[model samples]
Target chain A: MLHVFGHLNPDTDAITSAVVYAGLLTRQGVEARAFRLGEPNFETAYVLRELGVELPPLLPELPAGAAVALVDHNESAQSVENLAELRVLRVVDHHKLGDLTTASPPYLRFEPVGCTGTLLLKLHREAGLSIEQQDAALMLSAILSDTLHFRSPTTTGEDRDAVDFLAPVAGIKNVEAYALAMFAAKSDLGDTPAETLLRMDYKAFPFGDPAAPQLWGIGVIETTNPGYVFRRQGELLAAMDHVKAEDGLSGVLLSVVDILNETNHTLVLGATEAKVLREAFGVETQAQLANLGHLISRKKQIVPTLERYFAPDA
Target chain B: MLHVFGHLNPDTDAITSAVVYAGLLTRQGVEARAFRLGEPNFETAYVLRELGVELPPLLPELPAGAAVALVDHNESAQSVENLAELRVLRVVDHHKLGDLTTASPPYLRFEPVGCTGTLLLKLHREAGLSIEQQDAALMLSAILSDTLHFRSPTTTGEDRDAVDFLAPVAGIKNVEAYALAMFAAKSDLGDTPAETLLRMDYKAFPFGDPAAPQLWGIGVIETTNPGYVFRRQGELLAAMDHVKAEDGLSGVLLSVVDILNETNHTLVLGATEAKVLREAFGVETQAQLANLGHLISRKKQIVPTLERYFAPDA
Candidate 1:
């Protein structure tokens, strides 16, 4: 059986792409099953219902000793824990390269697109697969969610290409309507602050300092109310601070999404240089914390900004 | 197996709703499988792919004996051929009621909202089904597509309620972004006129003297180019006129959608009541034919306009 898996803390794109791609493979006579790493947050559930598709079973943890084909997330040894133990058969993602093993290489398919769904769309087209309507709708939703509905800075030609390809198949004459509906659904913040915080997927990265093994932790909080976000900023920071002190991390970053304005309010805590935030974000901050809006996503928006900050020195 | 079917010539909402609803049912230990009536059009395919879900297998000619659970389209024996033979087990639609057999019905869930997917979302909630991320995304997409991203006049409280329920699960903070992307993708009309016309789902209805039944078809044509639409109008009318004259139809109506503007331009032919067109559309026409712009939809905009002129007393 072909095991189609996506990254830890899967987003709509990551989860949906895996499922659709697996379906395509199944239709082509391949035994395929779709799976996701981590539990699906609230927003992902909304998208699955809209597309009339079920979420693949959530993998309580990464595949410890199963053959896997990864999608969406980077495939560094750290990203795919126990990678050496499992047979990495394939890698399909949209992120920049990590330390992937070339000696025992998998079928790596990485493109500079906004979502892994776009790459899968290309493969489906190239393979001349008979795309069904429901599958098309799912792919379209994945692209919309991953690219922040195509507003993310990391969106590239491939992302737009896939959207253009799938738009007609989805029977959507106007994409704006779908985007607005998705945003309106996601912007409600009536839940507890912790729920909102945990509803999203997060990643932890090594800060490149051996002395402080846990260098940084990042999470995204998508919402509409800037006031609510500002109100809860302290709580999030305190939690991050505690995690950082306990884990001996250098810094923590949280991207609070302002759904109405299509911007991100960045919150930084810990020992990272304020200059790093300022240089990457082009905004000055005196306090150990920074609240910068309009950045939206760390992978698409924040990471690029961080790269710019690191480019001059490194 | 539990057959989960949608309307003939299913749209994104129809197809996606079927797939997701089936998924939910299957998760609940029901042996559910999704089915579509006809070949999936372009937009529906895009939507399904985005969700990473398999498109249900195309039903083998509307189930001569199989029980059907209809979604989106209303159940009218007059509209659906061979309805007298096939067993319609259940109907979950969000449209004006047509004559249906409710006396010996299986489950019947009808709501006057923008889409069938909205009703499905309610059912998921009522059943206390825990939706997966992909399913939630699909539902979110369906809401946007059916409600014109909440801009359509047909939008109702139920539609909004469905959106509110599904947005968080889809992980969308601002649906406007998704709407914009979906609209932008649809606005690009590089394909031929026939391709564009076939991209959307279509339905046929009998229009004429009750004694002489004939098909007066109405199908949505999504495109941005008014000139292309204007040209296609002639071709569509000629084709429809040929079919009408051959089959002794009284008239036919075609709705050309300028998806970007959320407006419909109608082309009416074969009917003698040109004044009905004038009175309903506020556009005076000679030569026994009419072409009108700024209309909403054939069901919401054209039918009311025509009914006023044809059967003013009713």
Candidate 2:
């Protein structure tokens, strides 16, 4: 059986895309099961329960050469620890091409859309398969979460079309209401541990020369109420510092994204991250924060900027 | 305008797939033109002439950020000199995942099929576009050449189905006869320069640790007349030696594949190439030739074997 999954720090897209893709493959007579690298975020949990879908079980350590399919992400740093050892059967992703190599050719589908959900819908249509109502709901929720209800810079016409096509099938009458409720659920982080908050939507990235890339951990907290996060900035910074040292990361940052305002106010753990923000984004760090104005979409706005700044020739 | 092309040392699939895909994109209201990184091999030339289709012009160096699309191949080492600078808009490939990175997500479609033509047909269908007679002929020829008329181990069921579907559309009355003619055209190497023969279907690959990979150049000569290739062994070996030195490659290999017999007899340039063939395949070199029996598909058999042998853990 092929295990299907997405990246660690399971956001709505990462968690639900695995389920939708696994269901699609299963309908095509492939014995595949969805798995999560970590616990789903609050919004993802809300989506699963609201859609009456079961939470995917956490992935266990599999022996080398186990077949797997990846969704939403293709980067090894964001995937399973044994990614190199496993045999990747397929990848459905929306991120930039990553450090992925296979012994043989595999099925790969990547598009520059806001969400993997948009690509999954296309895949189902291409396969001449009817989308299940639950799967459609999962895809709709994921698209809304990933695109921030079409407010993100990464949102494309295809994404909007997907939502429009899937809304009725998913039994969603008002997408705006559902999206706001999901955001509310996402922001309902009452006294969650500092480390848990920092890890909810984090990913490790390698920059500079690929041979000896500098590893950095970046976390994001997307919510309508950014002030709620700012109140716990002290704890979040301490957790970030601890994670940076523990993971031997070159630097660490946590971007608190104001979803409604479409702005980014990133917390800097140290001088290293501050220097990168200053040099890479021309933003000064004050009071342990860097205001990366209107740079809310990490995949579109933040990561690419940092990638160019740390490029080997740069 | 988007320029579509394949890998260096363009083969039938490499040259024709670009033309077919470019035409597909153009019909969809995107201004895309096909280009070739290198001159077409004899078989590709025959296909173009027989179909009365113009040869894709050789690609010139483009300015940084020029929009481009890749077909047949994706690895930077096998691509244009300024591949890193070019903006890759889409990639339709049938090869393993390569060291490709982008600033943003791009349209990527990869499958472990025998030919890119199969995927191109699917792409055209998904786009709700009709395949023109000329485009169909190009795809059919590419599928036949790449799969060695379904003799190669890389040939899959989809490739056979594609050929069956395309034969009528391409207006080819006798499929077998057409395939034999293509093979004959590919085999007619009559007095071509040794260097030219060696480079007609060659690609550079990087193996071992990705940070500092060991680069090797692999060349394949697939034909119905293997005796003719072996007869020019000395000159070919000299050409291989010159390329290995000139390119500063770690190793160079030229495999002469007998399409009918389904066998590989590779020329070993030096001690480095000889040792790798021996250790990797357990085949002894005799008279500077290593018999890699029944390993006719380079993409399926030879490259993967070498990749595993050169793996960091291996």
Candidate 3:
């Protein structure tokens, strides 16, 4: 059986895509089960509860050479620690290609869309399989969460079409209300530790040259109430410092995104990150904060810009 | 407009896949034109002539950041010189992932199938596009050539199904006879320069550590009349030596495959390749020849073995 899962810091898209993809594979006669690399974030948990679906079990360490399928991510840094030892059977992602290699070819499906849900929908259609109502709901919620209800710059026409086609099957009467409720659930941090908050949607990335790339940890907090996050800026910076040192990261960045306003206010961790932001974005960090206005989508707006900045030629 | 092309040292699948994929994109309202990175091989030329289809023009150097689509291969060592500078808009490949990175996500489609033609057929069906007679012929010929008429280890059920479905649409009554004719054309290497023969189906691969990987050139000559090739063993070895030196490759090996017998007789270039083959395959080189018996498929049989042998742990 193929063990299917997504990246660490399981967001709604990452968690839901694994389940939906596992279902698709099973329906196509492949024995597969969904697993999550980490605990689901609050929004994903809310989505699971509202849809009356059980959360996918957290993945345990598997023996080396175990066959697995990756969804929503292909980067080794964002995946399991023993990724190099495992035999990757399939990958479904929507991010820039990263340092992932296999001894043989695998089934890989990638597109520059807002979410993996859109690709899952395409997979179902191509396979001539009808989407189960639960699967449809899972995909619909993931699409809205990832695309920020079509407000994010990552939103593509294909994503919009998928939502339009799936809404009826998902039995979603008011997408706006559901999205708002999800966002509210996400924003309800409610005394969670600063480290937990910082890690909720975090990922590690390697930048600069392919050989000897510098590792960096990037975290995102998407919420309706951005002010609530900024109020704990001191604690978040301490958490970032601890993580950067523990992981030996070259830099760390935490972008607190205001979902409703569609703005980004990133917390600069140290001199390394501050200098990089200043040189890359021409924005000065004041009081340990960089007001990266209108940069709401990390996959669309942030990662690409940082990639170009750290490009070998650049 | 997207310029679609295949890898250097173009094979039948590489050349034809570019054309068929360009056609698929055009059918989807994408402005795309096929190009070839290098001259077509004898079998590809024969397939083009047999179908009365014009060969794609050789690709010209475009400015940095020009959008392009890749088919058949994706590794940088097998691609254009300035592959890193260009923007890859789409990639349809059937080989193991290599050092491919994009600033943003692109449309990537990869499968563990025998040929890119199989994946192109899937793309057309998913898009609800009818296969044109010419495109069907191109795909069928590619499948036959890449899989050696279903004799290659790389051949999958999807590849067989594709040929079965495409035979009539391609207007080919006898696939066996057609495949034999193509092979005869390919085996007609004739008085071609030894260097040309060595490069006809060659690719450079980076093995060992991805960071500062050691580059090796692997070439294959698949022919029905293996005796014709063995007669020129001296000249071929000289050609391999020249390529290894000229490219500063760590090692080079040219496998001369007997298409009829499904056997491999690889010519070891120097001490490096000899030691690797000895350690990896437990085969000793005699008279500069290493008998890699029954390992005919370079992708499915050869590269993976070499990769495992050079793995960091191993």
Candidate 4:
């Protein structure tokens, strides 16, 4: 059996992608399953429930010599354990290539679009396979979640086209209203712990050398109102410190995006270096203040900015 | 006009890819010309002269906002000056991607293959275009050059397929003879400065943190017999020092591969640190000698070893 999964922290794209792509792979004649590496976050859980699709079983670690296909991500740091030893049948991602090399060549498709769902939509079409209703809605939700409702700079014409194509198939007449509902579901952190909330959309960047390194983690909190996280800044910062110590993170940052206004406000806690962050964003060091004025998407904006800051010469 | 070029130190793959890809681009109805970032070395010059084709003009720097397509390389260190500011329309490379990101979406095709010439052959076929006689021979020569006459560990089935497909079209019934001629042309470095010979196929790897730094550069010299370069070790070491000082390179290494026997003997000259090579290959720090036992290709055999040595965790 082929086990398909995404990166570690199961976001909407990661979760839905595994499920939707596993369906595609199965239709193409593989006994594949969608496996979640962890529990889905609020947005993914809400969307899966909305689509009436059960979540895949949580897979903490991969078994030895398993045959698998990875969706949404390929980084070993964020992928299944023993990735290099396993047979990676296919990798479909939109992120920068990391150290995930296969023993033999596999089917690999990578594009610089906003979402893996965009690629999925294209792939399903290319394969002459129609997207199922639940997967269509899941695809729509995944695209919206990754692109931040098409406000992200990573949102290409292809993404807009995918949303338009899937939105109707998803039986949604009003995308704006659907996006608002989805964002609201994502916004409601409810009783989730501060560390889990912060880690929900976390991505790490390594600066300097890979060995004896300087590394920082940036976690994003996207909500309709930034005030939800900012109201609990002290608790979140303490939680960020906890994550920092656990992960050996040199710096920890939480980018709280106001989905309604399309603006970003960040809180930073540095265990070591913050020069890259300060230089890249022109933000004051060790400060939890300032609006980045209408920038919400992490892929197109935050990651790129932080990448350049971390490895300017790379 | 679309300006197309390859890496700085013009190898066969770098040079021919520009010419062949430019030919393809032009046939597909774009005004394109192959440009060279630096002067072609002996083999490229010899092959181009034999084919009765003029070398592209030497382009030391790329002007800001120039529309360009890069072939065989995407790293800014090996590409045109001001690559970040320039509009990169397309990138076709077979190497691991370094920090090459564009302001907008561009056509990108990256394959982990033996040669960029191999990629060009596949691309040309996909475009439904036939290779011209000169271009076919150039492509054949390039594949032979980069893969060390198909003996390098990086050589793949696709590369062998490309060679077989192109051999007849290139008017060479004897592929071995053709490869020998090409290798002989490359092997005759004949009075070329040691720095120039080494730089002909040099690829550098940056170690440690990008913010502060430990940097190392590796250069390979593949020949039918290693005696030519090994005989002039002192001059080569002096040239290595010159290159080290000029580039702020931490340590410089020359891997001299005896192509016929498939054995590599390396020379080491370290300005500051030799620990990476020492740790990686389990060699003495400054001993300037070791038989690497039939490891010819830098990409497959040498690079991965060096990368692991540099970053064990990565």
Once all C-alphas are superposed, what RMSD does model 2 give against the true structure? 1.7
The sequence of per-residue lDDT tens digits that candidate 3 reaches over residues B157-260 is: 99999999999999999999999999999999999999999999998888888766788889999999999998999999999989999999999999999988
- Residue B67, model 2, lDDT: 99
List candidate 1 segments past 4 Å from native.
Answer: A60-65, A76-80, A193-199, A207-214, A270-275, A279-282, A286-293, A305-313, B1-314
What tens-digit string does per-residue lDDT give for candidate 4 at A1-314? 88889988779999999999999988989899999888788888888888889999986476766889888887777887688667786777877665555533355667778889998887788667888888899889999998889877778898999998998899988999888888999998987889888888887766544445567788888898677788888889899889889989878878888877778887766524355556777756545554566667676677667665665345
> Model-by-model lDDT, in order?
0.64, 0.93, 0.92, 0.79
* Per-candidate total of colliding backbone pairs: 91, 1, 0, 4
The full ranking of all candidates by DockQ, starting with the best, is: 2, 3, 4, 1
lDDT of 2: 0.93
Candidate 3 residue-wise lDDT, A55-98, digit = tens: 99988898999999999999888999999899999999999888
TM-score of every candidate's chain A: 0.86, 0.99, 0.98, 0.94
TM-score winner between 1 and 4, please give it. 4
Q: Write the per-residue lDDT of candidate 4 for residues B1-314, one digit (tens) a residue.
A: 88999898889888998999999999999898889888787778777887788788766466777889898877777777688778787777777655565544456666667888888887787667888888888888889888877788878898899999998888878888867776777788889887888788887666544445456678888787589888988888888889888988878888898888888888877624356555776656445665677777777777667655655344
Q: Model 1 Cα RMSD, Å?
A: 25.5
Comparing only chain B with the true structure, the TM-scores of all models are 0.84, 0.98, 0.98, 0.94
Off by over 4 Å in 3: A270-272, B270-275, B284-286
Candidate 2 ranges with C-alpha deviation above 4 Å: B270-272
